[model samples]
Target: MSAIALRGPERVVIHQHRRALWSAGALALMGVAVVVAAWLWASSASDTFAGSGCSVENTVRGCGDTVRAFLDTELRFSRAVDYAGLAMMVLPACVGMFVAGPLVGRELESGTYQTSWSQSVSPARWLAARLAVPAVLTLAGVSVLSAFSAWAWSRAKGTYYPRGDWYEREVYGAMGTAPVGYALCVLALGALAGLLLRRTVAAMVVTVLAYVPLVMVLNRVREDLWPTARFLGGDRPGGDAWPVDSGMLTASGRAIRLKDCSGGAGDTAACMRDRGGVTAFADYHPASHFWPLQLVETGILLALAALAVALAFRVLRRRHG
Candidate 1:
């Protein structure tokens, strides 16, 4: 097969990792089953309350048992959805560790990569195939999980459980392309780490260490990626909005944090009036900002992934050639 087609290397990589691939597929299917079952359970439980005319907000004397049952089921479903989101959040780290340790690092550590290189498979081709196969599999799996997560979030959101906001850290990562971007980025980073360290355990540890801080920094700055809407005076964003900043506005229109003004005798309003504060203000990203933020973060991660892939290939060529 031609190098451009990558058919030969692709086959070799797939065959080598077939066991791991099957295991990953089984896990993905199990996740789908869990999500489906949880949704069904919640929906069925909801029927009891629906027929009784008792919602979470409106509970009558005779509807106690029905409400309790509905709440129990809804809480379970909510926990399932949350756990799924947490899994999606953790998947990139798992992918990175696997790519670093078993995929690339183990071969290089054991000198097996040389065998592949000697068999007319150039170093570049070998690395590309290694990256491509896992990338495709990870993408497919994450996309499927993300779709279901989004579905689950939509179904139970804004109901009794108010924990599934789109902007929330776990929900945000699981429901959109951001998780895919993060996985791809970590995958490339793992390959690069493996190439640079040339040790399975070392590369895995480094990938995890590097990824943790990267995610932390991204989460810290995520709200600033897009411009926030400003609301002055009595106007405020809806409950679903992600509040970025809130403070009191001075008479001259300068924004000062509420914490800066000390409440005299515990009277915050009196303190605010004494400090030239005219009105309260808030800055937030409404629900419409979800797509824009997701796109921006995903774009940044993709660029980083491309950079990591280039670095990995460059390192491989420099050392081998």
Candidate 2:
């Protein structure tokens, strides 16, 4: 009945840390809102530019910048998929590295895990409550944010697929399906790191500098090294198409509108400009294998995270014992 103790189902030990919960929730919302607003503003600018009176041949500054950013925002992405990738890939990773920023590290710092473990509640449950509540909220926020990103990018002329050039880096996938799993895993990692490191700052730093990078960078590096490998998902973006089958240059290429970005056919279409759509370009090229590729790759990563988290539980129990 004190600040450090709570009774609940052994499976889910949820303590009421209203302050931490509120803070996490607020931070998550703000992070996602920033992406949403950036996308919307970009989308609106793109739309306005798409419709504005400015002609490319005209001698006026006109909607040049507006049109560029607008088309850049959505072009070739869905709201959910876009946001999902960002949330899952970037946000959750950051938060997951930090979720334990308050959870395990703080407990160890205050030496509360010691007191709590002495109670009937096992070390597992203590970490569970601390991790579970925040993990759930963080994953939920990730899902919402990803959904919006996908929507915002749906109208993009060229989409997020990289055809050629350096612009293909923007087209990432949705965080909803895969990100939830990742977020949970990240929470677990946070707890494990916090417990092991016994310092929230160190845990956070390690999570970001070590674990998150390890997970995130592999795909990128593999894409660069053995792009044709199926397991690596290659440089073909998020889909499973053979690069030979793709008429475009490579996955590393920036996104380019096949048509004029202004909606007309001729020279100077947005597609011709060769802007990178999204990182790892997952959208565009209708009916291609990108959809399946995105789903499968996301599944693999999330599963890895799940496994990591499960292992962390064991480690927590061991340490607690």
Candidate 3:
């Protein structure tokens, strides 16, 4: 019985993908955990941000700033997930990568591609169904997580890049739904690697090596295009600079000051004001570069996915011959 309508072995590949469904569910659960943590964080930090704990004794940055602009506002869904949502949005990629790698690569390693190779369906159709079904699931899971993140971040957009701490935007902007795109790209790479190496574990290793660089490059590429943020010493504490993207300065031309330590406020303490740069330089305005960077980042990831698909088809054609 010659059939190309995904009747026989193609269903098996799709089922293999489905067998990994628990990982996707776990990703969804992780999203819930992120939301809960955000609620707890906002609740506890609300009082502190609202002028309750403006002291040199506090360990948190901007503690003495006496700024609660966002805190005064109610916590809404948009604000809760927007920036913090990146954590959830990105979690699925890890799940998707590990899941995608084994779906067909394992079969190929076991010489199952041969069974399908002997069929009328062709390697192309086999790969297509295998990649498409799970990628769709990955996308759906990501969509939910991103929606939550966007809504949450929107609520507290004011806190996107709070003063003296530019890490928020860096984290949220670079780390958000961007990972979803990376996951799809990784899946494509997995399909290609599974096709080429024909070994599940080896293909996974290749996928990891290939995808990690792409992911890291995706983030750095965002910074590079935006003329704004950049990696600060490989995601660790050290000598690396991330240019601050404090929105455009007020029309009043009033310079926002970076305060200095008088040493009397304690060695670990700092007092900042919106006055001038007598103490230090004010944050750079990243407003101009933000979206440009985002677009660049998104484009790069999609490009990687496209390249993988293109190569997958090419390799499948070769295998067909």
Best by lDDT: 1
Task: List the lowest-lDDT window of 10 residues for candidate 2.
Answer: 160-169
Q: Give one digit per residue, the lDDT tens place, for model 2 in 1-321.
A: 222453462223334356655675686667556656655665565567657766545536666775455445554334433443445467656666666666667778878667667767777777667765666566667677656554544533344432221113344434235455556556667766777788878888776765556555644542333233221222544432333222222356644333324456654422433543332222233233444445665566666767767777877768656
Which residue segments of model 3 deviate by more than 4 Å? 1-11, 37-96, 117-119, 151-170, 173-177, 227-289
If candidate 2 were superposed on the true structure by all CA atoms, what would the RMSD be? 11.6
Model 1, span 1-321: residue lDDT tens: 223455688888887877887897788788878877977988888776788887667777788888889888888888888888888899999899889999999999999988888899998888989899889888888888888889888877844774557888988989788999999999999999999999999999999998998899899999999999988876678768998877778879887766665553677655766778789898999999998999999999999999999999889879987
Could you estimate the TM-score for every candidate? 0.90, 0.59, 0.60
Task: Compose the digit string of candidate 3's lDDT tens values, residues 228-271.
Answer: 33222113223224454222222455433223334335432133
Least accurate stretch of 10 residues (summed lDDT) in model 3?
A: 231-240
Descending-TM-score candidate ranking: 1, 3, 2
Q: For each candidate, how many residue pairs have backbone atoms clashing (under 3 Å)?
A: 0, 43, 15
